[model samples]
Target: MPFKASGRATDYRAIDRFDGGAGWIAHPEETMQRASHVLRASGGEADGGAWVVDPVNADGVDDLLAEFGDVRGVVVLMDRHARDAAAVADRHDVPVYVPSFVDPDVDAQTQPLGGTLPDSDYEVVRTVDWPGWDEAALSDGETLVVGDAVGTTEYFRAGGERVGVHPLLRVKPPRALRQFRPERILTGHGEGVLTDATRALQDALDGARRNAPEVWLNGLKALV
Candidate 1:
């Protein structure tokens, strides 16, 4: 079954809820299995305000945001993942933020993101910057949020990876991500890795090339 986007989600499943953050998959049954996240500013000026990332609009998404506080902004980490970002940002009356290195082809107003996420400790890490592929990751030392370059989805993993490099990138995994040792990794697809995330990430990067053949086979099976 090829991946297909669904209409506005009627229901969503919440996941990765921590002290100051939470995540949800709006279209849980969709093959793409895209997930969105909200991270609240812990102690900064933006305290209580939360940032939404790669959102896919759902019926009660606003209620989920209310749990953390006000919605500050909507962030798009992958150029191709414009998803419901603009619509969500408009609904929240906030700006849509795209990484400074990314020139998304979406038809919406966007703010260039660089350095740290405004009002939060999350620092933007440029993960991929090739001609057609531009992606970014965010981390505040503890929780790591990635999009596209890596994921926990069935199509993204091989035999026993808690997380794995995106199948297309398996042969040349993003080295920029090797620097962090996050306690938990939230992705744009599938569920997050909440335990032993550091080792899971390291294994994914270190074994990405070596496991390419298996990943390819897994991806093929997923498509069928």
Candidate 2:
């Protein structure tokens, strides 16, 4: 894949696949694409215009954007070690959201490199303060994007689904890929276009209301 501009080569790896609600695993057929990332529309026709999440490698933003032809907005999630997502978002005309407290301007140059984020790029305010983690809005179907506020990884697995973070990267549980209970998932580099992901996500939301409240609070705590 083509790079964004010209400069230092950023460290980026591609996993095989990412399936929200189902899980993630390696694509034995294809080799990982570390130099670039990818994204696709999820939710289908009923979704109207929901898109999947994608994490582009260093200088790989252009390749990811090519899929959209031209997009409206992108919710950016910054990982502690991910590349400067804001610049990528800014360059693409999308708005990047950090863990509530992250400064788009300052952080645009601080993130380290190599990691995953809440695939969604929009903000799901649930609170009033900054937290180490937060959600992003990428696809419609009531989808929420998760940033690297929590962790990073190459592949994701759960329930019955399996997908890689990109092309060449493989995620290790507990560390690389932070297993989530999302109804549908959009990786920092790719998006999950599920047909019934909304319902699944809604259930997760309701469940969070019942149990994840404290986790959300923890994020709020981090912001302060």
Off by over 4 Å in 2: 1-56, 59-61, 71-74, 78-82, 93-139, 142-144, 148-183, 189-224
What TM-score does model 1 achieve against the real structure? 0.95
Candidate-wise lDDT, in order: 0.87, 0.33
| Model 1 Cα lDDT, one tens digit per residue, 63-149 | 988887888888999888898998998887888998988766655678899888987889999999778999999998988999898
**Per-candidate TM vs. native?**
0.95, 0.37
Q: Compared with the true structure, what per-residue lDDT tens digits does model 2 show for residues 124-211?
A: 4321123543233223334434442221222222222233222111221122123233445444333342345444433333333233
TM-score, cand. 2: 0.37
lDDT score, candidate 1, position 106:
54
Q: After superposition, how far is residue 113 of candidate 2 from its true place, in Å?
A: 24
In lDDT terms, how accurate is model 2?
0.33
Ten-residue segment with the worst summed lDDT in candidate 1? 41-50
lDDT of 1: 0.87
